[model samples]
Target: MSNRSHEVEYEQMLLSRHGLWQHKGGRGKDGPMERSAYILLSRIRVQGPMSIGELSDAFGLDASTLNRQTAAAMRSGLVERIPDPAGGMARKFQITDMGARMLDEKRDYFVQALDKVMADWSDDDIAHFASYLRRFNSDIERIEGRPWPRPGTDGP
Candidate 1:
């Protein structure tokens, strides 16, 4: 198939997966957290506390939208706002212990679901697929000029 055709197929698959994840209780909650909430909590956990402006840039979202989202998270006790640890003027959001526990649970659930889906695949095949997926995400981040902090690396 042509590269363009393959890209279209890939996009379709991604949309399908997203739909399933969002609507099918794939996050292990009958009413899963909003996608934005999950991503925001996950990012804060991985990259440490971050300001709304910084998150806006990273997620390509407006500060006001993030403000509302963070407010909701705060109300839920999933995150807390504090002075920037780096001594910046703007406050940053940090995930709470409850948030971390929830994130870990959701991650485990997702992994279990993936294991079931890929049960027939060999270890080498799984590793290769993971490598390519990471590369794809990295390339997109590079193009967007907002690279995500990779785990186990000293990130800027």
Candidate 2:
């Protein structure tokens, strides 16, 4: 198939996946936590505490939108605002212990769901697919100049 055809197919797949995430309770239980919360928590977990402005730049979201999302997270006790370790005027948000636990649980559930869906695939096939997906995401992040921190690494 041509590159254009592949791009179209990938776009459709992403749209379908997004729809599933939105309509299905992908986060588990009654889905009390919003997807944005999960994403923000995950980012903080990996990158350590970050200011509203930093998160805004990282996610390409407006400060007002992030303010609302972070406010909700704080209300739920998933995150807390603390003085920036770097001694900045604006405080940074850090994931709480509870947030870390919840994020871990949600991650495990997501992995299990993927396993069920890919049950027919061999281990090698799954590994290759995962590698490709990672590469694809990395390329997009690089192009957008917003690469996420590598897992287990402190972000810049």
TM-score of 1: 0.86
lDDT of 2 at 20: 41
Least well predicted 10-residue stretch by lDDT in candidate 2: 22-31
**So what's the TM-score on candidate 2?**
0.84
Error at 1, model 1, angstroms: 11
Residue 119 of model 2: what lDDT? 97
Off by over 4 Å in 2: 1-11, 14-31, 154-156
Q: What is the lDDT of residue 146 in candidate 1?
A: 89
Clashing residue pairs for model 2? none
Q: For this target, which candidate reaches the highest lDDT against the unseen true structure?
A: 2
Looking at candidate 1, what is the lDDT of residue 141?
93
lDDT of 2 by residue, 1-156 (tens): 999979979986885775445534456553367789999998888899999999999999999999999999998889999998988899999998878877887777677768888999999999998898888889889999999987866573
Clashes of 1: 0
TM-score to true structure, per model: 0.86, 0.84
Give candidate 2's error at residue 10 in angstroms. Answer: 5.3
